[model samples]
Target: MSDALDRRRLLGRALAFGALSVLPGCNYDNLQHPDFADRALRAMSRWNDRVQAALFDPHTLAPTFPASAITRPPRFNAFYDEAHVHVVDGASWQLELFGNIAEKRPWRLADLRAAPQESQITRLICVEGWRVIGQWGGVPLGWFLRRIGADTKARYVSFRCADGYYESIDMPSALHPQTLLALDFLGKPLTPPFGYPLRLRIPTKLGFKNPKSLVALGVTNVFPGGYWVAQGYNWFSGS
Candidate 1:
């Protein structure tokens, strides 16, 4: 419990620092400037991502937990607070597929449900240094990609969410067996606060990589930096 509290405190401080670093006066882009601090930080972030990518084993699965280990009311997280959570209307929801795909169409909730589906109890490790276990059910991301005839050779798979959130993942992680276009959590349809309709559940990546309330998914070779990534967070935030 004390460790969790400590992690929470560290996360709070990190978030505060990130917020300040991106303020109007802060110039993170001028790496050649005399202030070497920002340059060093950016270098470290890139190094971390490279090392993780080199060490990543696509076949190795993240550890799963028993039902008893599942966290009750999994902690809610987003760029905004709970009150600002995007409320998606199920009746009007349609998922757009574009980019390097052979088929370009809008998918409804029924379309996803009809695909091959499975469930897993996995941990969601946050960049904030905390983690929680939850049961998520949906179609395997790879299966869905193949079903859509997507360009599997693409370097990245990116997502756009209803709440103005966006994120991208490397092809290896996107094809991982544990990665899911999650439609349900804890055996029930996801609620508004928890990203209703669809969420990306990736046990191998940090919480931020798992975007919520997905409105569009694209396959591309170009890097589509996420909301946090644009604000100087690491792009490949693998767990």
Candidate 2:
């Protein structure tokens, strides 16, 4: 049998043999069932998430590079090709707010720009084993979170994007100083192929966590999974 099939069979047997009992709130029967194997995989993913979260340091910052190190012609990445990237109208776009926040009003581009901005030259590490360094500038997310009176104690902060992508981060990761609602890339406003208007630029996590073309944001205690995460990518995909 193929190695991939062998691994799957091993995982199924592990679940049946109680190796998946380490996962909290999940019960597995001692039977070799297809559904049991799938649940076992999910349980393992959740366990990995908890381990990464425990190892994460909220105060530790990701390494920053000088301007000279910035990658030229920054690599454009998405689930879709650049030719199919959705163009958004910056003038008509509004960042809607929801859940556990005192401010429910939508914020426009100008409002976001008015906030104090920070710039960073940081590396974007992809889970596919590629990395690129680029310059990004925007309002610090932690500052904005406080400005909106969001309950920082909430467990998760979720995002909705123009391209139908959705993602969520832990509260500690959300409050990381390097996390930004990035509006500028390479000292210029983002273009359509990039995350025009606004995007999340989280240096500490893998590239997929930095979502593009943000349309909505919310703070909640409930779990809000991501597009790739639902397909079995690690939710706490730390660098």
Candidate 3:
């Protein structure tokens, strides 16, 4: 096999082993120490991220499903419990833009609604092992980036959420045609549990990378590590 294929196969094995280590009855405690096994796992995760990044194609689109395949009442996930979910007021919510952008302003929901909208039915694969397909509608993220005069050369696009959730994506994924600033779900305004007003729908990434209830976005050369990333989840997290 070619070197690239070999690397890909190795990454698959690393990922599978990592997954198995967390299953029920596994000796997770023994593996948690700062020993060779732990270090090796971390190294493999980083290597897998690099491999996925090098193989990523900006023009590639994730598979889409029909309306019948859409999951009803998409699952809710957050760093905190459901009771502690951030409830944003639609009338007062504004999206803040900062870092490497010519125009830094707070955008109201009406501003997003006025832009051209796109819709897609895509699957959200969670690291926790469940998947959901949902129909989302929103403005194309790339178009919004251009409209706001974002620095195209910046390396990362980062988000800050009302629920203390933060995440970042590489610039290539940020510019993907399927990436969206999602505003509606199931053909209606999004509910609080579903990230009302605005959420990111990045089909290229794992579910957590698509943060909900976003308050601000930053474009920068510096890497803005995510909530789960700092807690040892993979930084790239491409699906």
Model 3 per-residue lDDT tens digits across residues 69-127 = 99976788876568877899989999999999988988999999999999999999998
Worst 10 residues of 3 by lDDT: 4-13
Tens digit of per-residue lDDT, candidate 2, span 1-239: 45434433423335355655454543333224435556767789899999999999998999999999988878999987899999999999999999999988999999999999999999999999999999999999999999999999999999999999999999999999999999999999988777999999999999999999999999999999998886568899987
Report the number of the highest-TM-score candidate: 2
Ranking by lDDT: 2, 1, 3
Residue 150 in candidate 2 has what lDDT? 98
Best of the two (1, 2) by TM-score: 2
- Which ranges in model 3 have alpha carbons more than 4 Å from their true place? 1-40
CA-lDDT, candidates in order: 0.85, 0.88, 0.85
- Candidate 1, clashing residue pairs? none
Give me the runs in candidate 1 sitting further than 4 Å from their true place.
Answer: 1-35
lDDT of 1 at 212: 94
How well is each residue in 1-239 modelled by candidate 1, as lDDT tens digits?
Answer: 65433332211223456665554444433423413445566688889888988888999999999999999868998867899988999889999998999988888999888888899999999898999999999989999898889999998999999989999999889999999999999999999888899999999999999999999999999988898776567888887
Sort the predicted structures by TM-score, highest score first. Answer: 2, 1, 3
Q: Which residue segments of model 2 deviate by more than 4 Å? A: 1-34
